[model samples]
Target: MLKAQETVLEIDLKALKHNFDHLKSRISSNTKFMAVVKAFAYGSDACEIANYLQKLPVDYFAVAFVHEGIQLREAGITKPILVLHPQAVNFNILIENCLEPSIYNVKILNEFIATASAEKLNDYPIHIKFNTGLNRLGFSENDVDTIISTVNESTSVKIESVFSHLAASEDLNEKDFTLNQIKKFKNITENMTKQMGYKPLLHMCNTSGILNYPEAHFDMVRSGIGLYGFGNSEKENKNFKPIGTLKTIISQIHAIEKGESVGYNRAYKTDTFLRTATLPIGHADGIGRQYGKGKGYVIINNQKAYILGNVCMDMIMVDVTNIDCKEGDEVIVFGPETTAENLAKTANTISYELITAISQRVKRLFIGN
Candidate 1:
């Protein structure tokens, strides 16, 4: 068995379950809940997280790529899985794995239809993504006719759902814009369903959308950050327990004289004699270089230690002055005491980037609930 003491990412399944239940409570009984476990479950551990959620009877599981869905299937997940942004090249493999793909445009719709027909697949479920407002991925309103024609001409594929992405559901300032997107998506869904004579599950809400706009909770809500415990806003996060706790042991300590410098290019200079501790985590481990130079911090023995100097690929130095610490002391990089949200704000990024940027090299130890 792998020891928890040997890792940085300590995944709390108890917390994961807590967050899921919290979000579940907010959802309507008619609304299906889909858990987004892509990017290794936001860089925690996708397989373990999915396996845990599968036991909780989530309505659906979504991944960004076909291979990620395959990973969940390989891990014995038998739930309905959606490939949120599958490429045309993987349509066959996606079909083989019984994974649903989100058809965004004419090219992908045509490709999927051809592949499903060639494979002799009948009524394989697929989702249509409309570009309500995000403009990142999804078919435009003008492309709907072409998409409907493709679907009507194919006997091998069926529309499983029609969805869109919300560009700013978290910002209350953008409420009007978000509502506009909701209206657009509703209008598009109505138009397409009228043309096709059937409506699949309609979803356009992410974690933030699900919490902020219940009226737009069409048929399902896809949760990514909410499942991990950090909502897009502080108000939304209050109801959920955070699922990931990033911690590492201090490998070494250093005593610096006044005016002494630390790390690359003397990025941090001690104003007075201070104690500094170095941990075996750096940018390569997803700590990121932007977290250094007094911009970010970590919690040591419940005390805040400002980061010093440029973050290296395998290590970062923290000014632990005035705190009683030693080599091998556990350091909380971003957890209960100091959140990844706080760290991200200091680094001019977001919690999503902080969590998702966590490299695969970091060791993950899952604690089952």
Candidate 2:
């Protein structure tokens, strides 16, 4: 393990490759893979992660905004990048950088078409996102005619792919709903292709979707959380390794006598003599206040030290009375043993929330080349 002066998020590139290979093995041989590197690759350094995957030679990359794609382009990532949520103001930048936009609504589609025409671009690749069941984004299935008409009117831009987000591909109870979504996507794509005279690549699966519904792999599949080493299920999680480990060190230890209080607002009061260790991380570092007051914990010397008081913006106190630890000892906030999934569950959240919530201030160390 690398030494840490304070808090650090260690990213294992070897584990990342293992996850990519494992997820790739689950999909069809011809199906292409797109790595979702949005939100700084889920807060683990998007440039570095994407750069690493670029060598792995992923078929495509997806980001949530135009600035993210620009960052990757600046970093020399030449793969086709899909901007999932793009704004008109950044449409010109997207065009200059050759980043494709996922046109979910007519307004965006029209705006992008106008921009592409102004730029004198020919056959500019753009993706069409359908609403399917995730009513968050995408055109409604009922708007198929409008979509076809809009594309037919556009000569500068061409639909390169048609995709949708699965609402609940991970939940076994929602199997029927997932199947229905797949069916809807197929029908919408078929109708669009017939009208356009050429079929764009069709994809509708995310990480969980790929693992649970392989039959709907279509032309390509996207892997986000799964690429970061989570399966969204216990069975599949065993086959992958977590790529990130958040660790910190003990800054100081305090001996608290009975009736003594700890941390902001005196959230924890000692009933007996105790030893408390202060860690140099708290809500500001993405260890939110909700995990304070004895609800969350850290692993020290293979022992779980429960949080004893409220978490501050820069510090947290843990009950380390039983553990024989000293200042500078390594403390694991979440890692292989203390999985991010388990930690998020203790806070009544999910692994995605915890992993992505890691603050950018924390230094990230890449290991396992």
Candidate 3:
């Protein structure tokens, strides 16, 4: 085990593998799995996580943009990487690095085809993204015919897969909408494949979709949060183990008398004498200001330490009076006892936001490889 630092995110590779194997067991043996490693693997060392998953031999990898895929490539990730959102400006780089681009619209499709043709590339792999119900970054269902025609015109690029996003697969209340999305994606892919001579791979399920909509797990499935140990539901969360633990140390302790304030703007004032501990972490470290003033807390000595006042840029004061701890003592901002899901709930957010917000400046210590 690695020693705890002043502030570090302890990443457990064993937990990651467990989650991977668990999710993998849920899918069919023939179904391909693509691990989403975008946003630095949800802000937990993308290179390290991708390297580990590569050994698990996931069928593919995905990232939100071209630069992220490029970073993975630079780190020696040889697995086929699908850039979820690729711009025309980076077409050359994407081509040079052999990174597949998810062509979402007419402009991107046309531009990438033109660039690929100019580069004399042949049969280059490209994924097509349909909007379905997400209304995000994808071609609308009505554009399916146009998309097929455009792909047919491009001799340099070949469609590797057709996929879409689920807007609310995690919400049980949105089951109808999620099912409708799956149906729409199915119709789009079927129509495209019928028109084209060959059938490309079909995939639409994300992490939540994989858990809730097994019937829609087409030719492949993509997992992001699930790989990092979250299932978007209480029951499913219990089955997976969170792999990242945000930990820090108490920098100092202060004894404040009655009516004294703590931290900036006097957001927290003491009614009586109380002890507070200053931690070397704050909004700049990804614990946003909204989490301060009792909204968020930390775990010390197996007790909760509420934020005393407004979180500062690089420091935060926590009410540690009741807890027995000293300077340099270990503090779990969020880990096994206080999960990221719970911390995000306290801040009125989700685990995705909290985990992804962890800053690059904070060190990441890998354990249990």
Candidate 4:
């Protein structure tokens, strides 16, 4: 361990376990949990996170790409992994690793089926994603017949689960839309299962859906953000603990007078006698340049320090004026006190984007209870 001495993402596995246990408390004994570990486990460390969760015995794991699953497998993660959006080109690699693929369209389904048949594979698990409301990457409801036909003809493949994505399950304003998606998903699953003469596991709820719409918990729930310690709302029980803390140290401090500029392009001019500190983080490390120029901030000595100017690729200057701070002092980029959700609000984006946007170059230190 680096002993919290540098720009690091401190991951609280205790909080993660607590979050998982809390979310699991909402469902019954039958509803399995699938932890989503895509995007480097939300910019923390997928292999480490996966390894930890495997010890927790989560029912399954999910990744966004085939290579991500492969990465986990190489890291000694033996749990069943579902590849959310696998490319057809990597079908062989996916099969070689015993990784399941999510088939969203008939073309990919046919291609996978052919690959399985050619390899003489038996019992290859595959999930079908339907576009209930999130039309980003899923089969249309109208394609139920085509989906059923494809499943019926595929002898080498075994249907594992049928799932969908929720676009706005976190917002109560979109309740009607989420309900509509739930109804459509249920209807499609029922019709398809009846037509195909086999009932695969059905799942549709993301973290928000699992929290806001418990009725749609289905057979399994795919949780990403909730597992990372963010609930749909702080009002939603307020029990979900944040699992990641981004901490950095002040590299340098400067005392400036009025009219003195700071950072790239001299975007910010000190209004009064002030003290500023440069953080060892910026857009290149996923702080994002849009958050610069006084728009974003960091917390030092329990005080908020506004960004002094444009966020550089490797550094950001903060107006630590009037605060008791010094070089090598710990600075909070985002954590329990300065949450990623709050930071996202500052950047006019969502927490999902904020967490996922964190670059891989940042060191991540994992901790347990």
Candidate 5:
């Protein structure tokens, strides 16, 4: 465990390695691994996470946009990066940086072909995303012929891989839908390979897909949240260790009389004489205003201190009357003992939103490096 002076998001590299190893153990050695490092590695600092995983030597890396891949390149990442959703305006630069693009629609496929041709790039690697059921992005299942024919007409671009996304692989209730997605993916890949006379690397599994739907693990699998230590299932989560711990310290303490109000709008009125501790974190730092008014809590001296009132942008007050603690005492916003998943439940949300919402303004400390 580590201590925090101010608000900090501590990233434990040892816990990260533990998570990566656990995920790798679930897949075959022959199958390649692609680490998705988009959204600042799910808001934990992309360069740091990517650099660490690069040493573990994942076969590939994926980002939601070309700019993210560009940032990785600027940060000295040398491995292949797959831009999951690239815009036409950035396609030329994407090629210039040697970053692959996911061509999901006819327009993207056609524009990327033009970009590659303009650069005179031969066999430039490009992945094709097919819409199975997620319906967020990807070519329709019927687009296989269109995709293959378009690529066949051009030597500038080449299919590096064919992949899709799983809508709900974690919930067993969605098993039938997920299976149908897999079936469609299989059919799309078969058609793609038979027509092109070549087998591009195939992948589709996300973090949960890697765990619950091992049968769908194709030539390569992408792991995002799992690498950060959340399996999205209670039983599977125990197998992973969350790498980030949110921590802060008490800045001041106050003894309020009964009926005294605390925070913005005086949302919380004391029922009896009680002491409260003010902390240096609030909604702007990713805690959110909804967590105020006793909905969220922090651990002080191993005791829960429910938030007293409305959360300020840069501060929060907690009822710490019972705890034998003082100003500057260490507090656990959320950590191993009090997991983010548990804390998020108080807000009617999931761990993903909570963890990723951590404001970059908060200092980040890396341990066990």
Candidate 6:
């Protein structure tokens, strides 16, 4: 519990383990866990998180691209890394790294087989993504027969897992839709398993899905936000602890008279005398412009200080007239108690976007192995 002298994101591995064990408790003992460490582990440092989880010994690890998986491999991660959206060009390198690819459509599957063949690889691990309702990636249910035929024809690749994503597992209003998605995934898996003559591992639950729909746990479950300490609902949120704490220090303070403006474009002009604290963090640090102009706030001396104006590339001014904080006083942008989810709500965004949007330049410090 040391104070931050400069802007830093403190990553608590203890909280991460707590979140992991919490999510792990919800699934059956036989179920597997897939740790999603894409987008730099939701902007908290991917290699560190993946390395930690690799020791937690998650059954599988998933990333958004081939490069992410390669990074994990380079980090001494021996567990199977699934590349969720790999390109044809990277397939060769991906195979060389022993990174599995998620084959979403015909072109990707065929091309991956071709690449595997070129590398003289037989039965290369691959995952199949089905478009249940996300519509962002994955193949159609109708494409299953074609997928079966394609895989049947190729000894170059093997289906490691069959999975899909839940579109709105967090919103109870979309419960019916979410259930329909589960039904479709089960149906698809049934057909795929029957046709393939052997079952690949099956998974569909994200963090929210893990909590809300245990019946869809399939063979394994993926936890990304959950591992970062967010359960996506008010009730379930209490069960997890946010691992990354964003903190900065006040660089300086300003006394502004009425009609004086702060920051770019005069976005915030005080109508009365006030004090402002300029912080060394802004859009470039992942505190976006949308969070400026009173839309977001920071915690100072346990008091809420609203952002004063337009966020600059490397700085933000916050109104701190009533707070007893001064220059170099530690400021909390978001953490376990304040919670990124709450701060994100103020800016009309989700925790995923807020956390993942954090810039890479900010230093990261880890606590507890």
Range of the 10 consecutive residues with the lowest summed lDDT in candidate 3: 1-10
Error of 3 at 21 (Å): 0.4
Q: Once superposed on the true structure, which residue ranges of model 4 sit more than 4 Å away at CA? A: 1-3
What TM-scores do the predictions have?
0.96, 0.99, 0.98, 0.96, 0.98, 0.98
Better of 4 and 6 by lDDT: 6
Q: lDDT per model, in order?
A: 0.88, 0.92, 0.92, 0.88, 0.92, 0.93
How many residue pairs of model 5 clash at the backbone? 0
- Candidate 5, residues 1-369: lDDT per residue as tens digits? 666788999999999999999989999999999999998898789999999999988989999999999999999899999999899999878977889999989998999898888888899999999889988999998888888889999999889999999999998999999999999999989988999998999999999999988899999999999988889988998999989899999999999999899998999998899999999998899999888999989999899999988999999999988899988899998887698988999989988899889999998888898
Ten-residue region with minimum lDDT total, candidate 6: 112-121
| TM-score of candidate 2 relative to the true fold | 0.99
The C-alpha stretches of model 2 lying farther than 4 A from their native spots are: none
Model 3 residue 61 CA deviation in Å: 0.5
Q: RMSD of each candidate?
A: 1.9, 0.9, 1.0, 1.6, 1.0, 1.0
lDDT (10s digit) by residue, model 4, range 135-189: 7999998998987777677679888899999899988998999999999999999
Model 5, residue 286: C-alpha shift (Å): 0.9
Which candidate would rank higher by lDDT, 1 or 2? 2
Please report how far candidate 3 places residue 309 from its true position, in Å.
0.8
User: Predicted candidate 5: what Cα RMSD to the true structure?
Assistant: 1.0
Per-residue lDDT for 11 in model 5? 92
CA shift of 135, model 6, Å: 1.4
